[model samples]
Target: MWRAEESKEAYEELKKKLMEGLRENEKIESILKALKLFNSRKDRIFKEVDDLEELREKIRRAKEEVIENLDEYIEKAVKKMEENLCKVYLAKDAEEARRIVRGIVGDAKLVVKSKSNACREIGIVDYLESQGIKVVETDLADRVVQLLGEEECHPVVPAIHISKEKWSEAFSKETGRDVPPDAQAITDASREGVRRAIMSAEVGITGANAIVAETGTIITVENEGNISLVSRVPPKHIVIAGINKIVPTLEDGLNIAEATTLFGTGQRFGAYVSFITGPSRTVDVGLETTIGLHGAQEVHVVLIDNGRRDAIRDGMKEMLYCLNCGSCLASCPIYMSIGEKYSCGYFGGIGLSFGAYIFGAQRAFVDGLGFCTDCGACSEKCPAKISSNDLVREIRRRAWERFGLLLPPHKKIRDAILETGNPFGEPPEKRGEWMKSN
Candidate 1:
């Protein structure tokens, strides 16, 4: 799937389709609508709180507490998890993560997955499927894009750019059957199909929103209950998550969850928030503890680094602090205009730099860099104050040094000024030709 020819063709086709469907006026309308909804929801959520600033400060402190003693917290969590009969593996990178999962899921033919950016980060689905596992995405948006053989276009709402009309068409094409374009019918059809997949899945995987070190529990919040179904019905469940998701306590996890929900989906809380400690167990009939009553019999937590530790060591720890709220995607003008093809695995301003670094800096820096308009809206709304614009510039500079890519357009304008002493390159005297004293 990552072949150069296929990747290039896919990129070109995506760009053409997006450009044709998303005009400047339509982009403006979408942005306005999204901003209105986001701001209204933010206001409603923040209105009842007595001291918003205090809450933010407390959350920041909680994050600092974890970062200051990361190792100790991880050890504590591992020990607690082991006591709960849950297997834990700490992966130094993507390869290690893949190995750990493969060992646990040996010979499993069918696997179902929740919508996890982390899985995409490690190329989990593709790798497992290549190894002869039939992997299926259970999330509605994820399933839609996967069935269409397309990459995700947004971080939070993966298929928001797809209209209901197009969704119906895609469903019809994929299913080889006539499907109505009516919204309710389309939704029901998709849901029923995925429901069957979830029930029969042998192994289920999900991403962690937050991990409570104190309780050794992982939390996942989603609008659809698919994640719960996947994690519960499957015989084995694996949670692939970044190490930085660990929090010091359950309260801290809850606080992070609330902020993430408001920032990500413009909701106070998601429809389902699953806090799983270990496999489901019961001691009823014979007074013998038996696991897998209602939930997965075996649970594994794979803590993946995959360059995150290196990013932290290089002083990019703030990026690790992200709750995956995806607020930046909603607020980014570039993302609103172009959709997921431009953003890819990660979305919005922050994703541009991180995705490029992890995926391929040269390609991302040159192709994805120009997508951003240097609009400050994303940074302003970001809960973490991550300077995404600055990171993009830095990545572009590195790309030029490493791969000899072209400088960004703004830099070219600046270079012109330095070479000719005038940004316009016209005669200095002619600079005032258009000026008229009123």
Candidate 2:
């Protein structure tokens, strides 16, 4: 408040105006409780870390090194991966990325994908499905979310908003199989459904945790082992990764993966950490190399720019450092309280940055990015140590500049305050009715 700055004062003032009108949202109560338990479990798992800051520093150095030399790293990665026999394409935006994917996936009737924020950011699954290609989510929670026709809230546990009973209902409805409300039955049923999809799918699409520039390795971490299958079983694999995922070496990538799972789900070592140098090949028989040995024969890596370069260019490089760990969402009070109401899937602080930097302000402000309470909890819990407050402020500023990025509700409140000196729009004299009664 003492900064004497118009934007900060106006931002906080607007935030106050928004929060003053907060109401009890009953739908999120159970979800909030569930998130609490989930956080506690994550905390227990993370408590075993020794010298956490040191690990974070190592991660920071690796990421910063890559970010500082993003173009150089990307060039190196592309060269190495191409030399490894993987077709690499760099897309300037989401549309081009989708276009390239469509071409790569030409004539494919069915495709399966693992959970990926980049895929979500580009709406690739939906885009592909729109082109008459069937895309199934292979990740357990993601599959459930797809079956439930819901948007994922948390990146790591996308289906956490839905109960096991709800999942059972969705699975039963989807598979036409007897899946009881029990976790085991639900899990078994989901696994069976994903396995069927995996077996029948013609292609697999996944996002990379890290793309190593040195060895041209694509690193993906998962606990369900579904990522392993989804990226391998099909004859063709399409890897969609933001250029920000590129690190200098396999060691850097592994460290990133380690941090991702460690912070994402408290798994020190996830069940499967796949390092894909190229499509699976065997050189045993006759000293001849043959591709497609229990893995994808054709591998296409789409290094999506999609605003990542813009993020770096515009000095919002911190956005590129994100691990997609969802730790910030888990720790943000605003998110925990009202869930997606605070920010729609991938449209909150980080999502806002995603929208502002890459997708443009129009794409982000539609979700009402103004809901961020500026509590700094998200920034605190973020393993990458990105400042959501600063990012949100910048997004708001740029968005305001572009299109007045003010929400309809906020506009109404602004009008109300100007006309009636209060947000409530009741008769001014009636405002003191409660005070008189007390």
Look at candidate 1 and tell me the lDDT of residue 78. Answer: 84
Q: In model 2, where do residues sit more than 4 Å from their true spots?
A: 1-27, 344-347, 406-438
- Residue-level lDDT tens digits of model 2 in 341-399: 55534735887777776667655654547767778877776678888878888877767
Model 1 accuracy (lDDT, Cα)? 0.75
Per-residue alpha-carbon lDDT of candidate 1 for residues 110-184, written as tens digits (9 for 90 to 100):
999999989998989989988999998888878888887865666676665456777798778766787788877
Clashing pairs in 1: 153-340
User: Each candidate's TM vs. the true structure?
Assistant: 0.84, 0.86
Over 4 Å off, model 1: 1-36, 48-51, 170-178, 283-288, 370-373, 397-438
- The alpha-carbon RMSD values of the candidates against the true structure, listed in the order shown, are 4.8, 6.2
Best by TM-score: 2
